[model samples]
Target: MFFHPMDFLILIAFGISLWAQFRVKGTFNKWVEVPTRTGASGAEVARALLDRNGLSHIPIEVVRGTLSDHYDPIHGVVRLSEAVYYGRSISSISVAAHEIGHAIQHKEGYKALTLRHRMFPAVNIASGIAPFLLIGGFLFQALSLIGLGIIFFSVAVAFQLVTLPVEFNASSRARNLMIAEGFLYNDEENGVKKVLGAAALTYVAAALISLLELLKYVMIFMQGDDD
Candidate 1:
């Protein structure tokens, strides 16, 4: 009900995140229609990359949802959205290869990827309880509870920060693998770049939004302590 300077930062972060989402979707949509020279579906591309990297056992599954492709390190499976799984478009190839990149990262034990996976449990717990802690602390004017909430939320923010490099590295690997594996030719690779680059911005925007939220909670906690 009350306005604070931090509220403006939250608004700005929200706007940036919204714009990032729109930009990624628009970029993906634009390139989704462009066909690849090889005419290989996303699933085929993923399989080739995984096999090329000596991960032949890793299976590619069709998942429901737009842009939902991801590599599940726990099960050692690559999940691709229906479009990316069956579509042979440039967008599909780029996204499919990017998810495969994560599989490769797991195989190679990339430090950042490993760290992010290790932090997942703690971050999940913190994310779930942070809001309740913040609300209860405010209602009861409990500085300690508020501080605990800030600390927990900070952990989640830290996880997001660590994710940046992991995602970037995955995209980088995807780009390199696409070229090396002949998934995309010289000019076609540019579309893949645009797709992956747009996808990367979403992660950056997400991290900024998380950091802004953490800052907001810190400001609230400080104000409560002052009072």
Candidate 2:
């Protein structure tokens, strides 16, 4: 039995994405609990940054889940995972500061972040339709449906592209704030860097996976149209 090239590509992409996620998670776990010399909990580190930035009113709450930490711009809340909220490691501090960086972006009206937020609705709509379009196109041999899938996936790709800057900037801000605010000493800074760098890999993996999936659909549609 012969397998389609597009199917093979998707399999490879999914495998790579899973591997990347595992690697990032391993890196995070290995570093997340190693206590920082300063003995500051993730919550303390987060509060310091927010206070320094005059965002003291913004609430930091622990939300249950692994790697669930994020800033909710609409509600002015920073949600940290239990591991991060209670951990007193350089990794925890770095992750906390990173979420706070997003809060800062919200406060300052960062253009890319703003644009990404605005595009969320369209991106969500596109994502909801993508799988149906792809499957329907294949089942019915409809090039138009596949083309629509490609278009929707393109919107998702754009959202991912916009996300790159927002994430990278947050990491950058996190590192700088950690140093400038004395959250991590010089030697401890490396640990923070490693943790944040590992986290960034997951995002990179996601974008790459999305791109590969988009390519797979394009190839399928091209083959169908040629038939």
Candidate 3:
């Protein structure tokens, strides 16, 4: 369990994840200095987008973190980071629109997002329990326990896979909506794409890493069975 041939590939994916993280932060910070031509704050832009989509009932809240913004479907609120909530920069507008995109997805019943939401509870439990099961199975050389752990870990991997489409769809919706609503100028589209694209890379890298890890576990389980 300490290492395997597959560890090299997982390490490569991990490096990509780190690089994606670096790019997202760099892109966000760079765009944050470029003010939107409309001078609209992030919250204001989010409110307008929500209202335009006939989602006026949704409220926006300021949260305390950098790049920690998210839409809470249960409580039905959009939470924006402090920088994204009040800033008038391109980053602020891009992030705000992207989250509003998720709200719109919820309203429209986007299949991928809905599936992701449905998988959340089980994935949460499976992820929490999988590590212990796998560790114990390996220590005891129990193929059955390892198989069970693999099943649970696969659930988590599936969740990560499902998340990719949800994030990409949100970014797509945001770009189109941003253009149609005149939230960004024509030339400013590049900045929006850059910011959103960089952010999307993080999700892709995460999914890739999870997939590779899942494969590694499956291989190990198969080897144990053969032995």
Q: Pick the candidate with the highest lDDT.
A: 3
Candidate 2: which stretches are off by over 4 Å?
1-3
Model 2, range 143-188, lDDT digits (tens) per residue?
8988998999899988998898899999999999888988778888
What TM-score does each of the candidates earn? 0.95, 0.93, 0.98
Candidate with top TM-score is 3
What are the per-model C-alpha RMSD values against the true structure? 1.3, 1.9, 0.8
The lDDT values for all models are 0.90, 0.87, 0.94
Residue 195 in model 3: lDDT: 98
Model 2 worst lDDT window (10 residues): 1-10
**Residue-level lDDT tens digits of model 1 in 109-215:** 99999999999999999999988888888788788888988999989999999999998999999989989988889989889989999999988989998898787
| Clash count, one per candidate | 0, 0, 0
lDDT for residue 166 in candidate 2, whole number 0-100: 95
Candidate with more favorable, higher TM-score: 1 or 2: 1
